[model samples]
Target: MTTTPAPTPDSTVAEWDHVVVGGGSAGALVAARLAARDSGTVLLLEAGPDQPVPRDRAHPLADAGRLVLAGFNWDYRANLRSSGRLEDLLKGGDGTGNPARALWERFPYQLGKVVGGGSAVNGAIALRGLPRDFAAWAEQGNPDWSWDKVLPFYKAIENDVDHPDHPRHGDGGPLPIRRTPRDRVHALDAAFWGECTRQGVTDLPDLNSGEEAGVGPIPGNTVEGERIDAATAFLSDARDLPHLHVRPGVRVTRVLFDPKDRSRAVGVETERDGRLDTVRARHVILAAGAVGTPVVLQRSGVGDAALLGALGIDPVVDLPGVGRDLVDHPSVVIWSRPADGVCTPGLPWRQVAARMSSGFDDDVDVQMGLLNNVESHTIPGFVDRLGWPLVVGMSVMLLRPRSRGRVFLDSADPLASPVIELGLGTDPEDVERLCHGVRRAWGFLRSPGLSARLTRTQFWSDRMVANDGVLRSGVRHIMNPGWHAAGSCRMGPDSDPYAVADQEGRVHGTENLRIADASLFPVIPSAPTNLTTLMLAEKLARSMKE
Candidate 1:
């Protein structure tokens, strides 16, 4: 056992029934649910900007027309490309540095730093993974988390405007949902889907409703064009609750444990306005997300003991799983030019998605979609060549990537960004899977529908797409670490070596300490994690009530 010092709080004024460490998707729900019960006080802390993103019509970035470059996003100028193949390729007189690679080459990890976190800036493509995703989680010793068990929570939080009458949906929920109109869909996207249909892929009406494996317009969480972020959806009503207090612009440095028993976490040490303070609570819910949560745990000496000892902090729980098993979709993009006369449509076009199998097996592991807001300025030396207002592109993500990475401390400073290694394309199969998706994307552009509206054709380069080996190499060269991430503090049964928390969201070896965020997910979901993260909060809220 190592000796650790319990944090000395300046005052007890920050005490509450529950203290939530983030103001993102999961954190918002934690404060909202606990404060709604009229039993105890709740306090939420967000290290980012205090004010919410204005949903006013004048806010252009927040408009439905373009990608949200909200001020609250944290650009961790960190590199995600584990393999330096892309840089070497470019250095060797390569002119085609595609936007996906060039733009994200140095600064890859774009994380939400505002009250609602990712929901404030994401494309709002709310979706859930296949039933197999949750079943896999259950198989990893996390029981009661199968799709059937978690479906009710998904229903409880979503207010699907298009599917109010649908059996699996809820009537009145916090987040508003609207399916992108098929007629309003971008012409290129419509044609791409049309081509997919001609090729025998079925039409999935709603992937969020758990029906997967087809092409359809995705649902965005919006009400009258304004994003319905986690802060606006759940934390709105909680603000009126007298017992709830949300403190923004405060960063949590480390978890505070009870002096008598270090195994019991009771509060946290925080930094705000250049001052250190303490916030005590009966129960502490770390909702700082996958990247953020592990940093807190490791700083508090909750990770591997040897690592903590090196940093002059004693271990609270010798769980080596705190920063292990980091997972995310290793993705790539394919850019194409539209036929000369077709003026670009204005709306952000991450509006639809297609799920298909990458290999010979029938199971769906690849997700292909048409993105409209392709930033061509970041394209290679030939940016002057592909001249258009907005470019059309095909982006692909491997749903079940076998490649796993890690998250760990940089210098034991909570303010420091966690060093994230997105071990993408390390697995040979992942490279092949992405290559398959690329081939499919090439096919889509060459199809009769898109072919008529696009330039004869173009790959990142002629050499890149020449053959299978080169294609896979090109994939490794331009792989994106993915915008979303998960699995830093994975939850599982005690018997598992990487089990940081148990099924109930309770961190192992600690009392009154639980995790309620994407950090608890053992693996990244097949779908965008926004909806699933909310579902996790709903389920955890219900579990606490029980």
Candidate 2:
């Protein structure tokens, strides 16, 4: 059993039983689960405002609808490898010769700023990764992380409004998920899936039924048209708990480890309204996501020993893998010309996705999401950022890749955006794999079911789609991430050189500290990270209690 240290005579720092950093998607789960038990007090801290201001009082900066281009993002940049510096944006360069080059010399990699993290602003597509995806993690030395081991957590977390009667689905859960009725969903989305069936893919009416390796309508984490984000679903109950305390607009600058017991994490140093404060806790769980979690570790001297020495910070744990092995689903948008029909304004959360095994025969390694909006070709909605009035589009994505990127310090400042080297398309296999999906996407749009409804795209010239070689180059050039980022603080056996955490999500060489966010993923799941992230939080919470 673990012993609780006695308080010192002059101890004046605020203390809690557990201090959970970040209030994003994963953070909400941590806080909610901890506060539910009759355990000691739990404290949650968020970098953004905590209040759920009604839409009427929301400013443009704080607005949830416009999450991509708005100020509610930590816009990190992925620089070109040619210059290999963040300064490449000042003097722009053209395309890279190899598929191993940067998609954009300097493109904005946006991360959520609001309390619910990506869930508050994301497309709301709820998907679980393939079972094979989790099985791979078990092979990688995390046995408990196997798909079978964690399937119960996945089932328990969802309160499926559509498949509530399904044996695999749960009836009592905070996160409400619903399958869109056929009449409510857009025709274009329906046609795309219909064409997939014509192309030899069996129509998967319910993709989340543990057999999701086919084309289907995407389910969403929405309750009656409103988003049931992590904060909305989990934090509401947490807010009512007397033992739970939430502090918003508070940024953690550095983690506080015990000086005598260097491996023991005690609390964190935070800045709120420019006022510095020290809050101590018996345990600390960093759910600050893939990007934010590693930053905290590095800043607290748990990262690369040489880098910390250079930064004038004393090394605590000297773990070299603090911010390494970053992974994301690199995507490229395929736009068809304005269709014969006009896309109705303010449609419901429009999302449709498909999973296919590009390399393997059975297991899915590639997934594609089709969009019906102008701006996000990333996360589409009624909002339009592009000048093009009408278009049918799809986000072709390489779900799993051999490429690995990194998150390093831009400066010593805590508030600064970390230098995110989005190492996408770094491997030659990634390009070829994505190129094949792009060709498939083009072919699907050209099918009679899809092509009959659309005009040709104005964006693509003959040169861009001339042949396979040309399309491969185009895929490499236009590829971007699907905003599902993970694997910065990788989890594995401690023997792994790159592992930042053990199989139980505990940081190496430290006690009373664990990571429960996407950062702990050794590799990103083959689905939208929202559901997996919540399940991860539940796993960590239950494991710690046990």
Candidate 3:
């Protein structure tokens, strides 16, 4: 890849055919595709500095499970108070029946600030969200986003090593997808799967097949132990293209509008090294992620008219949905000590996960997966918090939570962090289902196969399960982000007042503006959103070319 210095903010206004913001998962791929197709001169801007992907075991990013690393993460925090009624119970207001004191406060929200975005640092699970996920998008008046229509994009974006010849899988795509071999799978994972079978959870070979839901090998995007993120997969070949300019450490402050025709977007205003400058572009695509994208739009005077006006910003578009309907996978973990022979540093971070329906007829709503080792397991200070040198974990996640939250601007400053409120467990059903998942997990842990491989040093006492109220309190204190955020900027027809953009990712109220990111999801998918985000970039890039 070519190394080109970012243009100085004080220099003459740089112009390009398209200016894509945020070089994370989607932006990198979009810019690469446009440039490789020779669409036009494209300028890609990223707020974080670029770093090479390191494969050595000594590096922080070497293990996909090492997600809590400090330097390269956005480190956004969210208010996870599900409701006010549970506040007292969470705070230990009741005299009894609370397992862990409730921490109903702002919790950490992880997003990659690096070039490859989350794909660079996240657990590399390559999941194609259930087909019904797209069907729901189509139901929301986005016909082009239907499962049948979007399946082609999904197929064309992956090079599945295990299922290359399968009709539904792709063999020539840039991103690589593979699973850990059965024989090489960790003992803990094998035991977990054995427990899954006893629980009547089917063992499917491919989780992404969309045929059946059960325990299966995790499909990850990795090559020789190194993550194949968007930057490595999409930008490697397109970086040398004379037309594409990748400008790291340059953050786009807001989208610029035509002075005369305020409804038309012209380009963007950017900030880098404390200097501010404007860049001209024929079109501006907001690939700034769900949180970043909505913040950008709000800063640019394109959110709820009242909210913008209260912040003394002129309203460019009166779309009230810019930062509403925020959704993320809310999860809680049950930690235990691994068997004497387990927790080997050589073992893969994750191997098997159970995807099953909590109650839905056709949809898989929950995910229970094993983390072979906790984040920063190799570090002493970090491991001290969990009180274990090395601990295995089973994360119970609500894949399709009914609760919805938001990311909104508390300050008009472009660089100011937005307020993130994750309304997790706001829906009573959410809490109930999570409690159910925890019970199932407890059963698995107590099963003969898993019991032999895991120690009884548990994060929470097994007796807590008998008390529903106490179990709910435990859910409140321990529930956290699954690191998958979406739906802040939803796509729908104009008839739907909350719709910010159309099916093609075009902003409805403005001209020459578009969005290509997870922010466009109408509903959070029933799986990790990494692969689906890449599929989105591939489809949007092709549409832009056409």
Candidate 4:
């Protein structure tokens, strides 16, 4: 919350020390950090308006439905050309469905068009990947990006409330971290944990302790019962800072490069209020999430030469990895009615934490989550209160997925939407892994305690008991994406032709320009990416300063 002298507005020209395109999770964090460093003027341009989160929409139960239906958000559609193939395998038919076509025909990928971006609408799950996740970077030839080098950045961005003795978590960082309170613990959750122990899965105490290979209660990026979106965590307080200028309703059309030398990016050309404006900056950072950053680069003529040429775009930088290697976590639901007591409303965050701390049995496959409907008439409510005579039901997600996809330009126009193909479970192993997750969820629901509370629902009743063909179909019916999209613009060593950026997040062969966002991750982390993107922004800001 630092204050400095404001820059004089010009009727003729727009100028800044740094121009950050896209005000999503990554953009907000980078803007706040750069401005906090007292670096010269920084301009943050968002393509959408600043829409406030309504109380009803903010509720965890309500948020899920809203995310799938809301408009002000950038609801980018993902093409599942691969998923259709999987369907053909099961149904013995032709696989030709196009989700991207269907969605773009109506809407777009679900990117948050508002100020906070996806963080404003995400499920507040705060998780970090295993230490080996980072070590893998070194193996790929990025020496400066090993686990040892990036651990400090992770610690600097978090404020953990649960394990005080833990060394990796910070206590006073801008983002707050804590488990759900005890009062909110639902009965279904307790039963689920007990079953997981019986099934030999270990209850992990922390997923963010540089070890994400196990199961645990999902930690959230929430502060005082509200979602701590990136904008609120990084930019809200910093809005008054004179060094930072956040423009909510501006769309960047392209990155402006020096015509004489394409190696250096000068600034950006944007459109606002039906007028075009160019903002000059010594440095330019693109933090426009996965799909956006790549599209921006392509529009700026920085992608595959052939692809660019085909689109009538002259190539500036021929980086083939600009829109490849997309990854995301997919989930499946197993619903059942408890035999007895009313299924509680809200998650039992505290009870789950206590179980984790007590050295509970080690069942390490699926993380069991307890979700309840308190008041809102969302999916949980219909299932728990109205759909049938039931107490509660639960869902478990496969945290780590092996699936990979891509983002590509559908047309050369910057205003035209890009193609995002989420090749979910295309890999046989990924399908098997998610099926295992579904089995684990069923085990927890069918346990002695939980099973005694209610009757099993009929939609998948006969299919649930079967071990072969029907099970796969049942899993496919329920499993969808967690909406954590990333890795389109991967980072790697100079030798990697597919790498969009180097270890410092600078786009390959480009000077005075960088990409500091989820787009920079060579591989998507095991957890929700909001906090990790913020941590990356903090690290990039420090790196730029030095």
Candidate 5:
């Protein structure tokens, strides 16, 4: 896809009605919709290169096998070690019996640097957050985000090919949603589902149709093996709009304010090709993802006054919650050896998954994905020594975690990546719930159907699963982020002390400035956040026009 070149540095005096920072999933759609409505001239800026999206051949963004392609990611690292208990558990003395410190060290965070953000690089699972998930947001002072109110926006973002007629699924929208046919389901995934069924896990044909608890083929935003992400969905046609300008490789540093009126945002300062420039706008919207948005806000002096003061930044807005309350699904995976001939040709890597409530009385709080392969250095060397083409892994994720973390600036420089400390296992309940999920996954691996197709013994030894203390240790050791980060710039009412943005996405203390991305989530969703991020943009863009 082609876009207009960015305006020259001196062109900062040329005013745009709306300037959007970050050409990610949310920002791309927001700019497209606003421009389409003739509301204003919209300028979308991205720090990464405008990657070539070719329909004729396979591309990394288009192929699930090349999910995390090199050179297209922001390459952020997160410190997951949060508590003293965790430190004690992971600390090694003389390096004798305990797993190496590297195993429990920092995790690599995958934030998309390209135009489509995560939608360009993610696994493309088109699942929605549970209705209860939105209800909780409403309860947190964002009544506009209630499930009933946001359902229309969700419908407006997708054209579901598999269940277009279903009341909950949409038929006409920019993105296409489809699921793998039962006959074409990967052999390993099919076995997983069968095992789940025997253990009373519901056999769900459609996981996104009102009911979320069950095992089924995942609905993805893929058509004919190519990705139709936000850029491909919204900006592809909107690029023709004379008012819309999607400029890649322009890195926005901070929102600019009127000199006299500190509360009013007038524009933003950006860096491109080692040249610093300013771009004036009547309104500035921050759709940078959870990590990028908070970094921009804090850098612009919109975070805790004390923190900003320490960094020598004059405070623009003293919103202490700007980078607080970071949330994500804590996850772990158990690798198993596949039986002979199980890794057949044409078998998909990950096409089926399960969401279970497990021991919890609440909504489905646990997610399980069947992975045919995972070539990560994080895994044990013994597994790699087996010499199989791919090792089977059952990943379990805690959907609703009570633990919270932070995203803060390591330096005032816009080019510097922020320090992300995911306080995983900070809350004992999170660890306890994850342990329960792990035990359930262990049972699934041992079930007749899966055992017949793979070795019952997993990389996480039977001895570890047998002892409660050992199981808890294993849970802490193997836990990883779900790659669904949110709540860094949460939305809520003025009454909420931690609310950075109100229900309309307006930054609490700044005029003509708003945020539309995963950062606006008061709480992280139970499912993959890509679809929800698009829905948020569709809703926020319309609200901005009104």
Candidate 6:
């Protein structure tokens, strides 16, 4: 276990009007807004280092890799459980070798432990939820969370490139949204869009207009040629606020509640500098992402009584849904070499035009620029060298997956990694849908524009493409998660017995305690989750002000 420095006398006992538990995407936004609202003092506590961009992880694109290698990111692991006997599987048993299965069985769900949390090291894709998504929330019992009510908040945080005249989009919102310029688009990306149009798919000019059915270039969280990570956008400038206090490197052990009331979360107990210190707060908001939030809840005695008792924890709240209903987008990559000279795979004109015309099929919801050079460190031995580059590839992700997973306590020890039960593809439809997505990718590659510039590579090995079963397996092998975890502390009406918070992000049964992060998302939207998360934070801030 990594030890944090002891809190000095000046830091140990301080009172605040609102205490924000995280400094990442949602937490930062909430803190900034709360402070700006003239709400009394607010304290932001982060478990990672104080530095914005740690020295070890210098490059912006390489931060994810650094977090994975170093233990800066929450390296959550899990045990595998069979979909056939999920209950029995949870009881502890051997797991199948499927990556998702292994995720449930062997590895703990990893979350970034730094100040910016996962936002500092994410693929910066910014997408808003579809109208149908919010309507579905109302249908599911969250009436106040309908699209009509939420659209204003969504618009309040976004500044779209195409529609500058819209009054809804705020020019001064902390989050930045911009179109990927044509000069930056790769040649293969242009071909992909061209093929989609040729196939007769309707092109969507803007996916963020709350209509997310068609295809277009994925919008990113970038501004002024630099990635606007949550830490940089929300926390850096606001740090000087006299009302805001930020404590880095402090690991919150558990939330402290009044034993008599049980509903009131009075404060939090944390270990700093090898010593235990308790800080009191009238309001406590948990923004520890899907994995960390539940863990904190369970540790603080707010979960299934039986499970808590088994782990020797006294139950404060018997919320069975504390660690259930997890969802994530799984993706696969298709690689091809272009016959022409190296594709200038940055933001380019051909790529922008293609993105503008990319909606050819209903199946492919969002299309990102597939670069010629693979710059990911997750894939072993593949590096993007400006010269002598021979391989090019595009990653195709399933926009909406039917798979559901969970995060649970592996042991009573709060320090041990939690057990993540990712039941991916257990639903036969999920597997079939992914297979269909791969076929769609094949169609896009065969488009005249792309085909004119590229040569085909084997699906896995040259021999595997001929066999349908092999092709399916290859797709599965190449696919990995795009992160974007949500739904652990889901928000909704009382009908959802497991939901931890209400529409305003206020934790159920608690007066001042609320959850202001991704953990409150009841359903993972069809688009990328980062922007939606920021929107939620903005909405939460407004609700708090009112």
lDDT of each: 0.76, 0.74, 0.81, 0.68, 0.81, 0.66
Alpha carbon lDDT of residue 272, candidate 6? 75
Which lDDT tens digits does candidate 1 get at residues 153-264? 8888988888887788875888888887889877778887898898878898787767668998887787656667888788877787766778788999999999999988
Off by over 4 Å in 5: 1-13, 53-56, 83-105, 344-347, 360-363, 373-383, 456-458
> Any runs in candidate 2 off by more than 4 Å, and if so which?
1-13, 53-69, 80-105, 357-363, 373-387, 461-463
Error of 2 at 311 (Å): 1.9
Look at candidate 3 and tell me the lDDT of residue 33. Answer: 94
lDDT of 5 at 462: 66
User: What's the TM-score of every candidate structure?
Assistant: 0.89, 0.89, 0.91, 0.85, 0.91, 0.85
Native-to-model Cα distance after best TM-score fit, residue 67 in candidate 3, in Å: 1.8
| Model 4 lDDT tens row, 65-153 | 12323645665666653433323322433333344435323213466787778887766667776566667766776677677788788
What TM-score, to 2 decimals, does candidate 1 have?
Answer: 0.89
lDDT of 5 by residue, 241-316 (tens): 8778778999999999998999999999999988989988889999988999999998998998867775678998
- Cα RMSD to native, each candidate? 6.6, 5.1, 5.5, 5.8, 5.2, 5.4
lDDT of 3 by residue, 1-546 (tens): 332333443434346788999999999999999988878778889998776633355566655655534777787876774333223323434312223423443466768988889888888889898888888998999889888888888899899999978888889899899898878777788888877887788988898898547888999997767677888888988778877878889889899999999989999999998899898888899999999999999989898887777667899999999988888888877878776776776457878988876543445668998888553354212234545667777788988898888778766787787777678878887887888888777777787877787775455777897678998899876777777889999999988999999988999889999999999999888888888998898999999988
Candidate 3 similarity to native, TM-score: 0.91
Summarize candidate 2's per-residue lDDT along 342-427 as a digit string, tens digits.
46433553556777765433546677756674433434322354555655677677777788877766456766667677677888
Q: How far off is residue 541 in model 2, in Å? A: 1.1
Candidate 6 off by > 4 Å: 1-14, 53-72, 78-110, 337-372, 376-391, 455-458, 461-468
The local distance difference test score of model 6 is: 0.66
Candidate 3, residue 540: lDDT: 95
The TM-score between candidate 5 and the true structure equals 0.91
Q: How far off is model 4, as Cα RMSD?
A: 5.8
